[model samples]
Target: MTDTTGAGGPQDHESDGPTGPVIRDKRRIDPETGQVRDVSAEQVQETAAEQVAGGDNAFGGGVGDALPGGEQDPSGAPQATSGTPVDGGRSADDLHPDTVVAADRLEDLRRLQAEYVNYKRRVDRDRVRDREAGTTTVVEALLPVLDDLHMAKEHGELTEGPLLAIADKLETTLGRFGVERLGAVGETFDPAVHEALMHLPEADLPEGATETTIVQVMQPGFKVGDRVVRAARVAVADPA
Candidate 1:
């Protein structure tokens, strides 16, 4: 065999064979700067990660020093605040949407509560008035019977046993219900409580007689509490 391989001659190497398609770098380059300005996807991703890592320190130093209030840290970043913001730098008008909604609902509830209280008070007052009105009506209807009893007593019919006792008991029961008799002879006449059926001139007036005095009580009046149920029919004596 002929020994053609010699030292310093063309070295035996692997043959260049057909392989997979090569990737092309088609990044845009600035014509003015001859430097490779285009960055790889890996480099861009790394830069983005760095920016994100330093994001928390953005307000730490330069911008923080320029701000008015609060303390700063050694790294030029603003120090962590001890407490939360009171109103989150918002005024009453600039409150959060959820906060405003909650406040509005609370106000509505308070208004409804007030309205309910007023309604309840009105209902209670009306109930009391209705009860008084019903009682007054019944008492008024029974006035004729009372008048008959008064007439019988004046004629000495109710002077004795059962009838007098029954009248007394009825009067006591009515008194318990706040019913009261009004108007008496020799009392001061009042337009509010008494109705003058006739006027008389006083020649010799009694003690405490005034310009308007009740000389005679023709019919007694009835009242319950401060409410007058019936006016007294009376004769008034005018001082002559």
Candidate 2:
């Protein structure tokens, strides 16, 4: 071997090899820009990595800046903040306040309406009960006079003297109050208003048919309005 050492590490010779040209690890020049590119690709990669790390440190890194209500970074990205954003030109809390108030008012109105209806119904029922009680009191007060009249009629003394006049006057007074007699003789007997004291069989009437004529009026009955204050006690005749 001949001495081949040159200035920069090694010198290239034509008889060095027949395979290919030898390339040296050294600085190169770009003919296009006429500037020297002294950096290797690995050095450029390391410098780019350092720049990325520095940028991440400045921006607080990752998804922290992108969160709502977060502090903003210098790169125009949103940062975390203590307060939340207002949406739709209003605060998030303010959006449902009116709806909540309206719902409460509606509930209050419904309760009031229900209470009013119940109060009306209660008042109506109480009024009806009070009227019935008053009518019952009036009818009860007239019972003694009716008993006297019935006793006089049964003794056949209803047609003479002041007793007849007194009974007529009492009946007239009761009639003004809607008091009517029930189960009179020769009238069809109704079980709703008449009580049969004795039932006798008579073959002159139709078979299985009931003779409802009041044969004897044992007690007088009275009604006020549509309600029977007293049921008539009578003897029903059955034709044989």
Candidate 3:
């Protein structure tokens, strides 16, 4: 037998037989690169491997550094020495298309729900504002008729007549709409609801009066809820 090996490993051997000398090449690891060489399929069949071996590392300097399994030995248990890439280096969700779609649906649903809530709030507010505005407009239009009725009532013209019934019915309807009159005589004078047409003599003020007081209402002011439609024209007397 003749040994014909290199510095890296035993490459081949030659032997003398009855016919002649037989030389067989049995190189395993490449002498130059120190990497394992590809064994013939016949040799692998003879060895009877249950799994295919992984390729050499094209990635980096980790031990068996293969592609998929990151956990194997040179005996080809499974290959990669580095960890498997999770979802193509993105996230685990990228691997799950259903999960990605579900997340997107959830976000859309949240946004739509928020938009609907805001729309509902705006519509409700606008509806209320429109209703109040319509009522206020109607009240303002009827103010002159109401003043005429009040004057007629003061002159005893509305004493048990069709005009009195009409006035009562109109006032009742306005009251149901939250309309109320302001600035009665002897009430405290307020600039918000009362317009002073004349300042009466302070001597006209009764005892214990502290602030300006309405002495006479020239025109009754009307309001709806907290909104003042018109201030009352009034005569005021200063406090004594």
Q: What is the TM-score of each predicted model, taking all chains together?
A: 0.55, 0.46, 0.59
Top-TM-score structure, candidate number: 3
Per-residue CA lDDT of candidate 1, range 141-215, in tens?
Answer: 989987788778767899899989999998888887778888887777889999999987743457766568887
Candidate 1 has which clashing residue pairs, if any? 60-76, 60-77, 60-78, 61-76, 61-77
Predicted structure 3, TM vs. truth: 0.59
Pairs in steric clash, model 3: 70-80
- In model 2, the Cα lDDT at residue 100 comes to 82
- Give the higher-lDDT candidate: 1 or 2: 1
Winner of 1 and 3 under TM-score? 3
User: In candidate 3, what are the lDDT values of residues 148-212, reduced to their tens digit?
Assistant: 98888778888997878888999998888788899888888899988999997843766677989
Candidate 1 vs candidate 2, TM-score winner: 1
Candidate 1: lDDT over CA atoms?
0.74
lDDT of each: 0.74, 0.72, 0.77
Model 3: CA > 4 A from native: 1-95, 202-207
| C-alpha root-mean-square deviation, each candidate | 17.9, 13.7, 12.9
Q: Give lDDT for model 2.
A: 0.72
Question: By TM-score, how accurate is candidate 1?
Answer: 0.55
